[model samples]
Target: MWDNIGSPFDYIAEKYDEDFSNSLAGTLQRNRVWHFLKEEIKAQKPLHVLEINCGTGVDAIWMTEHNCEVWATDVSANMITIAKSKLRDNSAVNCHFSICSFNQLEKRFEGRKFDLIFSNFAGLNCVDENEIRKLNTAFFKLLNENGRLTMVLLGKNCLTERFYFALKNEFKNANRRYSVALAKLTKDVLQPTWYYHSLKLTKLFSSFVLIRKRPIGLFIPPSYLNLWLNKHPVITKLATWLEYTIGSLPIFADNGDHIYLSMSKKITAK
Candidate 1:
């Protein structure tokens, strides 16, 4: 399954950072994710974190800077290559990069366990329902007692994307996120992707207790629309403020470009 989708990602690996990771909208959305991460893991000492689908290793680098030991893995070898290059300096020994998919976690880690399992952006959205369920079981086995799982996944309904496209009379594009679809990377390459609601994820990982969930791009526009937003800095600033303010409110939290969820493994009684 991974082999079929590897080409599209490998094609995009070199330009992924330039195209989204460092873009204005990507920076804004990721900053929101980082804020929650800092609040969750900052004071924890000697933290060991495992990041799945860690494209280009941006979040892994940030984790290491905050004194956490990080093992970042991605399915695409080219993506892992770019990530490894960014951390090749001897000083970044705390961070490690490998090529592995979400389904390969158990095989890769074996006896290892982490204090946190983190995945940013919409990496996990590439899989279907079954894969997600398997991931829940794998994550439970891979995490230490009371360990946490933090993910930023594409939401089922993105108000900003819907509104943006609807205004342009692109109805199908507006609603494309509501169901499973093929995301086209090149003329011939298409990757299957799924959008998930917060409730669905909570239920899928029911063994873990949900600790936090919030809207990430509710008011802020998606990365594809950043060019239009860049032309209007003041509006972008106000939208970002709104994003941080009302992002966690009910009805608002799950209606964004992506949803951020944090869940902790439940300790079982002996």
Candidate 2:
């Protein structure tokens, strides 16, 4: 069912960073993710990390620079190619790249276990709940005792998305994330994407304990508003401040354009 996942993402590999990863809005949201990442890495330095759907190896590079060993995987070969190219100059970096998807993690890693498993952006949104159930199983098997899983996924309800689309009178677009929809990867490629709420994920990963949940882009606008945000630096700064101040509140944490969540594997009784 997900055979075309790689093909769609491959089309965006070359310019994905330029378009989203480095954009003003993207930087703001990603910085929040990085903040939480630092907390995770600080707790356990020299971590063994498995990163799934590691587009362009941005996060992997960051982790390796901080003394972590990273095994980064992406389904798109082109994306992996770009990721590998970025690390070619840094031979000392302890990072590896591979072509793999979330569902295929079990077979690929087999007996391997990691101290942390990370997925960024909405990469995990491509699969449905059934696939997520499989991922939960794979995560449980692949992680060491007390290991953490960190993910940043698009949420089912986004205040910014709702307001942005409503101003344009795009009623359907405002609520598009509420159901399964095809997200435009590029002009010609649309891939199936699912928006998951924090509550839903808590139940899905029932075997694990939810340790952290933060709202990304709760006040910062989505990437689509990059042009407008660029023009208004002051508003952008204010939004950033607001997000930093109140994004962690329970009322707002699960309703952003994206959610950053971390869960720890439960130590089961024999």
Candidate 3:
């Protein structure tokens, strides 16, 4: 899916951080993901991490600050350029940025292995279902024994999004992610994207065993609804609290705007 998209991200690279990463909803949503990531990295200590679709290198720089050796990659050269600029003043010798697509992982880093293979915020959604399943083998070859693969993917079902769109009587738009959809990236650009349920993603990486999984934006609402959320700070706080209360419940875990999944590569007896 991403192969044919031809760098649609290039158009948004300059404003991505300002429009989404630094926005209120993005900050709140990312804090949830970082909470889990920090805990996992702290437990591992001195981890070697490979981050895919590392747009703007926000997480990569943070990992370097925590003493992890990080190789951050993105498919878009423009995104990679922006990421490099962000790290230029940091003096983080531990972090490296490169332009490499998900499909190029095997060819680009054939013998490299990492303690953690991480991709955040729907980056993997750019690929088709078959390509995502193929990642099981690619990741298996690149991960050390018992290493972890942690991904944050857009979920197939988001109750809040459905309700929001349904309120506008746009049922088709509400259900757009039920399978594959052509997501509008900009006014004139559309990219093929896929939303996966937790079970479906797990099945794709059958060689790995699930260790942790949770919902993000379960009550927080998707970023597109951020304008309303920003205006209603009290409601946003309540939603955050509600997410804290029920986000991990099995019934709610895969129904959020995005799902967080962490799986460990199974040890195979030689």
| Candidate 3: tens digits of C-alpha lDDT, residues 1-270 | 123334889778888898889888898889888978887788546899999999988999988888688999999888888889887555357899999999999889899989999999999999987898788999999999968999999999899999989999999988988877888879998878988989988898988999889899899888888899999999999998888788757567788989999999877789
RMSD of 1: 2.6
- What local lDDT score does residue 191 receive in model 2, on the 0 to 100 scale? 93
**Each candidate: how many clashes?**
0, 0, 0
- Models 1 onward score TM values of 0.95, 0.95, 0.94
Whole-model lDDT, model 2: 0.89
TM-score, prediction 3: 0.94
Error of 3 at 190 (Å): 1.0
List ranges where model 1 is wrong by over 4 Å: 1-7, 88-91
lDDT digits (tens) for residues 1-270 of candidate 2: 123344688888888899999999999998888987888987546899999999999899999887789999999988988889888566336999999977788999999999999999999899989989989999999999979999999999999889999999999999999899998887789999998999999888877899989888999988989999999999998999998888867577677989889999988899
Model 1 C-alpha lDDT per residue in residues 163-259, reported as the tens digit of each score: 8889999999989987899988667778899999999999999779999888899988889887988999999999988988887675676898889
> Which parts of model 2 have CA positions greater than 4 angstroms off?
1-6, 88-92
| Model 1 TM-score relative to the real fold | 0.95
In candidate 2, what residue range of length 10 has the lowest lDDT sum? Answer: 1-10
Candidate 3 colliding pairs:
none
Best by lDDT: 2
